[model samples]
Every structure is written in C-alpha cells, then in structure tokens.
Target: MQIFSFKKFLKEQFILLSLSAIVGILSALFIAFFLKLLEAATAYRNSHFQLLFLLPIAGWVIYLSYQYLGKNSSKGNNLIIKEAKGNQESVPAVMLPLVLFGTVITHLFGGSAGREGTAVQIGGTVAAKISEWCKLNQQLRSILLICGIGAGFSAVFGTPLTGFVFSLEVLVIGKMEYKAAPYSLIASLIANYFCLQLGIHHTKYFITSSIPMNGEWISIALKVGIASIGFGLAGYLFSYFIELFKKIYSKILPKAWMIPIFGGIIIIILGQWLVGKDYLGLGVDPNYPGAASIVGAFHAGGSFTWSWFWKLLFTTITLSAGFKGGEVTPLFFIGAALGNTLATLFNIPIDLLAGVGFIAVFAAATNTPLACTMMGIELFGAANLPFFAIGCFVAYYCSGHSGIYTSQNIGIAKNSFLQIRNNKLLSQHLSQKELFYHKKWTLVKNKYL
Candidate 1:
C-alpha cells in the first residue's frame, strides 16, 4: 500500500494524466465505432422481423466463434473484474473484437441485451494490451485499467462522473480505490468529450420538478427510501434469477450450444405470444406508439404495470442462453418501468421516482452505490441529491452480497455483523454460506423430522 513521496507523487500523477488522456482517446474511438455498429445492426433487425427466427443460428455462430477464438476470454466481464482484482494475470487481446462481434450479433438477432459489458471489455483489453507492450509495472497497469474502464463507461453513457466513480468503486464492494481517482476522472472527462466530438449521441433525461431540500424534504427522502427497497429487490431478483437460470439451463441442456438454441426458441415463442417485441432488443426503443421505454417511463400511462417483469424475463433468458451484451442498460429499462408503476401506486412525482429507479437498481446490482449516486446527479441533475443518496444507499444494503459481476471482491461487508472475509470474491462468499447453511439444515431435518 506504500505510495510515493510528494515529489514522486507529483511525477507519477503527471505521467498517469498523460497516459489517461491517451487511453481516453482510444476508448472513445472504440465506443463510438461500436455504438455505430450496434445502431446499424439494430436497425436491420427492426426492419427484418424474420431475423428473429435466425437467433438460433446466430447463437451457434457466436458459440463457435468463442469456442475457436475466445479461449478464457469467454469469461466476459468477470475476467475484467478478476484481472482488476489481481485474481487473473491477463486479459486476452482478442476479447476486444470477440465481445464486440458477440454483442452486435445478440442485438442483430433479437436478443434482449445491453452495451456496457462490451464497451468495458473493449476498454480493459486495450489498456491491458498497451500495458503489456510498454512493460509497465503492476501498479501502473492496474491504474491504466481503471482509467480504461472509466473512459469506456463515460464515453458510452456520457456520464463522466459516474464513469470516474464506477471504475474505482466497482472492484470491491464497500471499498473505493482512491489511488486511481485522478486518472479515472481524467480519463472519463476526456473520453466523454472525445465521444461527443465523434458525434456519438447519448440519451438525455429530463425531470419536470423536484421537491425542495427543506424541512419537508425529510418526508420525501423517506418515501424515496421505501421505493428504493423495491428497486433494490428488483435488482437482487434480476441477479439471482439470471444465476439460477444458468444453473437450470446447464442441468437440462448439458451442452453450451444447445442451451442457446432452446433459449432462442423460448424467447421467440414467448416474445411473439406474451409480450410481443417490446421486451426484446434493448427495451429502450418505442418501436410502436406508447411502447415502454426509459423515456416513456417519465410520464404517466407510459409504462405497463408488468413492463419490468417482462424486461427482466427477456434479459435473464438472453444472458443465460449465452447471448452477448451487458445487463446495465436493460436494468435501466426495467428500473424505469418499475419506478413508473410504483409512482402511480405511491402518488409520488412520476419523474422523480423513475429517476431514482434508474440509478438505484444499477447501484444495487453493481454494488457501486457511490458511482450510481453520481450517475443520478450527472444524468438527472443535483436537484434531488439527498433523495438520490438515500435511494442508492438503501438499495445497496437491500441487495445483500449478490451482484452482476461474480468476480467482484467483498472488501468490506455491508453490515459489520455479516463478517465476510476481506478480499474474497462475492461468488466464493455466497457459495460458502450456502454450503454451511445446507449442512446445518440437513442435520436438523435428520435429527427432528
């Protein structure tokens, strides 16, 4: 944990600043190009409904590509997290193109997915490759990777502050890596600027009004806290079900390729029958009038009551089936839709609740409460800062130890009494606890019943 002297600190900061600038530029370029490719692919899918039936074929191609070229790269976001936590030595250079291709195909073939995972992979791959070529030390390599994550996140979402905090905060729950703070921020800002310069547009959210931070704000914060409990549980459910579905699919299908084929058929049948196409392919586009979307969720009557459930179902099926794409964007869609539904029930402002769900669910699922709070400010503005913090913190605690990234470390337990060992991966901690409880339950059942 030793750092540097004042003089050495200044010198290192200067070097990292310059390095982050370069990383930022590279990340923005990659994100811009990838986003354009995604847009084109999505447009094609929207125009050709028949392509939905081709999803099974697309899954086979994606599987074969990974089997041939991916190697350990199939680890996906978990690999990047493991590398950042020093659990893995390196990320394959091929992961960059492999993930990009996989994600594009997922979208092109009507899989419900998101873009953040692919962008983060692109960033981490680029940073790792550069660090290897330059022969940088481990500390420097780690810093560069953090910068790369921040740059990629900011470039894609256009939320520089969120990206900055997310990079350092996401590695270990309840712990932040301040050592990489300067580089993360620098990379995020520069990358966002570069993405905008490249004409890659980001979505903008608008809230009509927010309650003033006066004595009455206490009541508002309490309401937000209550709402965030549901948001947090929604996030937790999303993670739990995705993992559970993976287990179920593996048990039934046994083979990886067959899983996607069955999953594709289910998605198509369910999509065409139950929810139609609204829940597939991002869930952010209003393909028809009054279609559910993050934008529409801000207004009353804009989202159906079960919109969140449908999105969640599609996302879980898509990801568990081995389709590419991230969970964050679809999480956004789910959160926004659920928030809209809750607002009607609670009689709170529709926009405010929607905004809270937008970040709170992500905070819980990612275990990056601080970053998600900043995302609220960056995306929705600071008018509801107190509410945002309350919502995020409540959701974070309610989310338990589960998260989207299985490789994330438990640097600090959410509750002091929980007593999870420091630096253990979340998956390890959860599995150990499950085994312990199962043994205790079996003994009790044999002794009593």
Candidate 2:
C-alpha cells in the first residue's frame, strides 16, 4: 500500500507541475503582448492629444462591443474570484479579447485606469480554458486558476514571490491557502522569467536613504505608524468612492450604455479644464512623464500635496464610469504621492516614505499585507522590511473589512466584535452592515419623532 501511494503521489505531482509550467508560459506571453500594445496606445495618445476629446466615442464603441459579444465577461476579475470560490460557471473565454480591447481603448482615450485587471483576466481565462480542455476535476481546476493568477501577476509586475503569495492570500481575507504554494511559486517564477525573456521590463523603484537604528528609530516608527493609518484610510476611501460612484452612475443613468458616455464626458471635463491631463490614463509614461506620476513621488518637489487625491478621484471616476482596468497601479500612485506629502511633514526621507506608501496602500486595499511586504522587498529592497511590515499590516487593519474586490470571501472576520459570519462574501457583508446601520437609524428616528 505504501509503494502504491508513493507512485500515485509522484504521478499527481508531475502532472500538476507540468500544467503549472504551461499556464505560466502562456500567461507570460499574453501579458507581454498586452503590455506592448498598451505602451503603443499610451504613446499614440500622448502624441495625438486630441484623442482625449474622442473618449466618449471610444467608450461608446466599447459599450457596443461588450453589449454584443460579452456574455458575463463584464464581471471582469469578480468572475475569476467567484470561480475560484466554487462558482459553477467557468470563466468565459471571451473575457480575454473583450477586456484586452476595452482596456486598450480606455487607455487610448485617456481613461485613468491600470493594467492589472487585463493581465489577471487573461490569465484566468486561459487557465479556465485549459482546465476545460483537459477535463480536470473541480479541485484541480481551482488550483490551476490560482496558478494562473500568480503567473499573470508575476509576469506583469516582475515580482514572482509577491505573486506567489498574493495568489494564495487574495482568495480569502485573513486566510492563506498553503496547499497551493508550491504550484503558485513555480508558476510565478516561470511566468516572470518568460516575460522578461519576451522583452518586457517592469518599473524599478529605489530607496536610497538608510533607516536609522539609533534613538531616532523610535520616532521613525511612530511616524510610519501614523502614516500607515493615513494610508489605510486612503485605501478605504479609494474603495468606498469607487463603489459610491458606481452606485451613483447606475442610479442616475438607468441605461447601461449611457453610463460610459456620461462618465467619458465627466472625465473630459475634469481632465481638460480642472485637473489637467496629469492624472489621466496609467499615470506612468516613459515618453511623457508627469510631475504627479509614481516616479515623481520619489523626489522632493515631485508631487503636489493634493496629487494623491486627484489621482484617487480620477481613478475612481474612470473605473466607476465603466472603464476597464485594474485598480492596483493607481493605488500605487496614490500611496506614493501621499507618502511623499506626508514625508515632508513627518521629517522622513521622501523616497523611503514613498516606497512604503506604494506597497502599503495596495496592501490595505487588497487586504494582503504579507504579499505587499514581499513586494516592497522585491521592488525597493529588504533593508526596510520592518517598516514595510509595519506599514502594510497597520494599513491592512485600518482599512477594515472593505476592499476593492467585493467578491472576495472573508474566511475569518477581522475582529471578533463584529458579528460577521465566516465564508461570507465582502459584498454581502457590506450590505448586511449597511442594513444594520439603516435599521438602527430608523429606530432612532422613530424614537425622536
């Protein structure tokens, strides 16, 4: 019996590893192509400048495309999360072209969004198709989906370990799936390697200032802790505003297609007249770098005090307006900008604060402190891992139970004081909380009146 079990284990390991490699390579290739196209689109938009005016038309085309061809593909990243959580529906294959096209158009027309959504969708769709082709069981299919997510994240960001850990951590808040670690690691490394081999390069950030370990260490820690609270609030506000804007849009424009048009017009008005073009699109362009970009946040006088707020507002509007893209990169920009602003006030090195904010905001919004800490080490260096941990974990708790991914399940409630049920989706949890508050307010009103 021992011999038979050993043989079966070897076979299963081999098959799973092989599938992981395939997913990694395919995801990397797709991400590479997507990045190249995205770069070209951004370059064209920068040079033309007039394309910004045609944003409404571009949005209309995107709306029409999805209306005609996208069958549940509009759910975007939520669909993948739902599938990983045992949803009966498979991730639709049409999601790849639809998201890719929609995101590209969004960027081309100066929609302030990020690329992580497109990359993740591509990876999930590919993995789902491969699982269908191989007729894998539900368990195996779910594992592959996790592998796909890691690969896509790794390939796009060039951070394999972060990707590996994020894949395991992101499915359920306050829980990590250690069972998928080896597969996710292998997939992330392979995808990052192949993405680089395909001529794709991720952005680099530096922290030149060394953290002091002397008596000043206490002061620094306190400042970081305080700043982390702000980071968490920024993350909470970002998620809150996006959902609020989405609700407002849906309420005002009952027609699904009209939402994008109205959103496009708002973006144009905001972009051209009020905010300038600094906060539009990805906010990181090699060809036309802005004072309010992620790179700019690293230096003194690089960003205005309110630069982070503008980016946050632009991104929330862009995403809530039915534009397609991920929220992660914009979160990075916002965090970094906020960090820059706070560093001057807190007497910390600007670059160091920016670095922490970059990862901490993402950590708060995603509720993945461990992954963001790893990302900090990967992007900025491990010299300040303690600061990274403090910022990330603090921000995570401060952000509360809210996050950008509403479909994400809460495996463990953040606090026992809250009467949240285990394994409840965040969306459901938020709705319940709102209902509870509403009921309390109604009782108060009746009593007073």
- Tens digits of lDDT, candidate 2, 1-449: 44568887897788789999999999999999999999899888888877888998888898898789888898888898777666878687889988988999999999999998888888888888998998887888888888988998899899999999998999999999787789889999999999999999788888999967987887898899999999999999999999999899989987988988898999999988987888888986432554478988999877889989999998999898888989999999999999999999999999999999999999999989999999999998899999999999999999999999899999998888888899999999888887999999999999997
lDDT per model vs. reference: 0.88, 0.90
Candidate 2 lDDT trough over 10 residues, lowest sum: 283-292
Tell me the number of clashing residue pairs for each predicted model.
0, 0
lDDT of 1 at 258: 94
Task: Tell me the TM-score of each prediction against the true structure.
Answer: 0.95, 0.97
List of clashing residue pairs for candidate 1:
none
Which candidate tops TM-score? Answer: 2
Cα lDDT for residue 345, model 1?
Answer: 81
Question: Across residues 1-449, which tens digit of lDDT does each residue of candidate 1 receive?
Answer: 99758998788777778888888999899899999999899888878867889898888888888889988888888888777665446899889998998999999989999999998888888878887887777888888899888888898899999999999999998899888898889989999999999999888898877687676677767888899999999999999889888888989986788988888888899777867888778766764666788888888887889998889999999998899999999999888998899988877899999999988999999999999999999988888888789888999999999999988999999898887889898999878977999999999999999
State the TM-score for model 1.
0.95
Question: In candidate 1, which residue ranges exceed 4 Å CA deviation?
Answer: 1-14, 213-216, 440-449
